[model samples]
Target: VINTQRAELEALRKKESKYKKAQEKVSTNKLLKDEIEHLETELKTFEDKDVEIGSLKLQTEKLSRANKALMNDIKNEQKRYDFLESKYKELLVKYNIAAKDLEKKQ
Candidate 1:
């Protein structure tokens, strides 16, 4: 009877060890699953940021082109203003000369 009791005890110990090992495996699997989910979320966030960056870059390029065109227009307008100023000066001098000639005759 003592021998039979010893055999039963040993069997129970073996079962308990197997159960502990199974529990450990389950815990490890849960941890790995949670880690995978976290990584996936992070990857999605990075992809979204990449898309936003691309859109911003496109907008910056368009604005840069518009700025260059506006700069060229401003330069052309400056040249036109200078040309008009020179013509006005020349006309003023002629008018003054004509007025002096008239006063001398009188």
Candidate 2:
């Protein structure tokens, strides 16, 4: 009877050990699942930031093009003003010469 009791005790200890191992495996699986969820959230955030950065880059390119067009217009206007100024000087000299000639005749 004592031998039988020892055998039964040993079997119970083996079953308990198996249960403990299964519990550890479950705990490890939970940790891995939590890590995967965290990584997925991080990836989504990075994707959103990338989209926002792309939009800003596009806006910057458009502004640069508009600035170039404005510079070209300013240059054209400066050339037009220079041409008008030269014509005004030529007219003033002609008028002065005509006035001097008229006084001499009188």
Candidate 3:
């Protein structure tokens, strides 16, 4: 029974402490009111920017992913172009050889 009472007392004390802090948030000590209000305003401003920062981070990630995908596509297209160019060069060589053979027969 004593242990249970102690635990309850501790819980109430924690709750009271939280309430006191909340009360201070609503109204601080008069002597430090101006300074505290300024600090609170600055803190609130930074907290408000949290969403904007998150959105910017998400946008940056998306753009980076898109850039990577585009680079890969460009690399694949370059490889395809190289393959076709090599094939064309090979056909040109074959045609030149055939032409030489025809000239010799003539």
Candidate 4:
């Protein structure tokens, strides 16, 4: 009877050890699943940020093009202003010479 009891105790101990190993495996699996979920969330966030970056880059390109066009317009306006100024100076000189001639004659 004692020998039979010892055998049963050993068998229970084996079963307990197996149960502990199974619990450890379950815990490790839960941790791995949580890690995978976290990584997936991070990946989604990165994808969203990438899309936002693309949109910002497109806006930047459009703004850059508009700025270049405005710069060109400014340059053209400056040239027109310089030409008008030159013409005004020439006309002033002509008017001054004509007035001096008229004064001399009178």
**How many clashing residue pairs, candidate 3?**
0
Better of 2 and 3 by TM-score: 2
Largest lDDT belongs to which candidate? 4
- The worst-scoring run of ten residues by lDDT in candidate 4 lies at 23-32
Regions of model 1 farther than 4 Å from truth: 2-7
TM-score of 1: 0.72
lDDT of 4: 1.00
Candidate 1 at residue 99, lDDT? 95
Task: Give Cα distance to truth, residue 50, candidate 2, Å.
Answer: 1.5
lDDT of 2 by residue, 1-106 (tens): 9999999999999999999999999999999999999999999999999999999999999999999999999999999999999999999999999999999999
Clashing pairs in 1: none
Query: TM-score ranking from best to worst?
Result: 4, 1, 2, 3
How far residue 75's Cα lies from its native spot in candidate 2, in Å, is 1.6
TM-scores, each model vs. reference: 0.72, 0.69, 0.56, 0.73
Tens-place lDDT per residue, model 4, 34-66, is 999999999999999999999999999999999
Tell me, by TM-score, which candidate is best. Answer: 4
Task: List the RMSD of every prediction in angstroms.
Answer: 2.5, 2.8, 15.3, 2.5
Candidate 3 TM-score, C-alpha based: 0.56
